[model samples]
Every structure is written in C-alpha cells, then in structure tokens.
Target: MTESGRKLILSYYVSIDGKSVGPTNGMRGVMESIDDEAQEDEYVRQLWEAGAFLMGRASYDAMKGFWPVAEHPSAAPMNAIPKVVFSRTLDSVEEWGASSIASGDLAEEIARLKAEPGKDLFAIAGDSFQRALIAAGVVDEYRLWVLPAAAGTGTALFPEQDGPLRLR
Candidate 1:
C-alpha cells in the first residue's frame, strides 16, 4: 500500500463470445499437457512475474478451490502471491499464503495499491470486475484476444444501462 493508495491493475483471459457465455467452452483447450510440462511452466513463470493480482469473490472461490493443490510449479507461487478478493460475504479468505479482503471503497483501495511501489498489479477476472472498473473510469488499457469463431449466445460484456461508449 502507498500513502495515496495502491495501483490497481486488472487482467483477464476472455474470448470473443462476450464473457460468461464462452469463457469455459474449452475453445482454447490446454496449452500445456502433462507430458509437455515446460509450456505450462513458462506460462506460470510469466504470471508470477506479473506481481500482485485482484479478483472478484466468485472468481476467488473458483481459483482457491483449483490452484492450491495444482501440480504446476507456478501454481504454488501464484497461489502464494498477494491477492485481494472483492466480496461482501467473504469476511476473509481462508486459503492462505498472502491474501487480504479489500477494505474501504473499491476504487480507493485500488488507488492506494497503485500508489505503492511494486512490479504491476493485475485484475484477474472477467465481466463484473471489468465493468465496475470501466464504469469507474479506472482502467488504463485493455487487450482483447480475438478467436477464430464466435458463439451466438451467452453472456455479453457490454455495460448495463443507457450510455454511450465512444471508442477511438
């Protein structure tokens, strides 16, 4: 944390079919198989190099259940890295390494984090968190990875309510 606030960096792996609709459709498949562990290792290494991360409560639960016992070398460090889960129900995260429930206002905490000295902070979820950040005008940049195909139906990633998003 910094005197001003922390810097909030958000990152996610999303597909063209909006959000929840195809995020788990297995389209990307497993880039790293058990036989070829090096590929997985490299990806994990890159993630670790990313520094701190943030995720919504739902995303946090899903991740906590999956990564603690994961065999990937990066899994341990990734799980151990500093994380903040945003949720009203979770008083605190039980699965420990180095994680804390966010306090004060969402944007305020993010600002505090951004003010602190560190590598880079990353938001590691989709839809809800992204929308919140966008709505708050806190996001710095976005990288959309387009796929070859698209799903006709599923969850959409656009913001709710009536407003215009003027893109450049």
Candidate 2:
C-alpha cells in the first residue's frame, strides 16, 4: 500500500525497447515464444490480487471485445474483478461486466477509490491515460513484463518526466 493507504500498480507488457503497443505485428509471436510458465502464473496471481482494474477508453474497448469471449486461464478473475474505465465520451459501461465509467476529475476519482476498503488498484491503459497518471505521480508500483523483441515503432510506456522518480 502507498501513503494514500491504497496501492496503485501499473502493469503492462513492454518490449525490450520499452514499446507498449499490444501484440502488434510479430510482437505477440515474440512474447509467446518465450516459454516461462512460472512467470506467467505469477503474473496471473498478481492480476487476481487486484481489487479493481483501471483502464482508458482504448484498453477498455479492446478488452471488452476480447475478454468477454476469450476462453483462457485468466478469464475467470479478469471477468470477476471490478473495472473502472476513465472516459469523458462514454456515457455508460454496461456491456463490460462489473465496470463503470469515470468521467469526473481523474485524480479525485482515483483518490476516492483508494480511500475505499479494497485491494490494490491495477492500472492498464493506453499511453495517453498512463501519461496522465505518471504526470500526476499517483502510481505506487510499476510491474512490467519486458519481452525479448522490439516493437520497432509504437508508444513508449513512460513519457518524459520533469524530474527523476526515485523507486525503492
């Protein structure tokens, strides 16, 4: 947990070059080629521990289409855990199970969620949303799965910072 009494965890799959565009071109193949069952299990365990998922419009859109239909080992927890999609344009999120739309101030909304009694919040969003969170200095921990290959061209996971962030 953070000083706010709730941990904000940012988890993502990045390339060796730090690109975070999901499974584009040959990236998915590269990621799958690495046979690491233990690591995969640990990642799934972490996902199961999250109290809720935080996502942007893009990730929420993509996940809503896929996770609802996909038959995978992580599907159960992925569907069970509550999700919050931060989008100003979206009026509602009924299609995505256990989800709600957050159209208000991002920081305030997150703070409210943090104050509530729950497990750590897991963040998985598009670059723009993630950039906003990083700029706000709200994330408590970063959990990245660095793949073996490069994405060639895509969004960088971390944006330019005004100052260095010290991590323990």
Question: Ten consecutive residues with minimal summed lDDT in candidate 1?
Answer: 27-36
lDDT of 1 by residue, 1-168 (tens): 333444444444444654433345554442121345654566566567556777778878878877887886767767878887777778889785677887567777777667777766777665677678767766654544344345444455563747765444
Local distance difference test, per candidate? 0.63, 0.83
For candidate 2, lDDT tens digit of each residue in 1-168? Answer: 866778898888888998875655467777767778888788889899999999998889888978888887677778889999999999888887899988889899888888888899999767788878877878888888888888887778775755775666
TM-score of 2: 0.90
On lDDT, the candidate that comes out on top is 2
**TM-score of candidate 1 relative to the true fold:** 0.71
Model 1 error, position 114 (Å): 0.8
* Winner by TM-score: 2
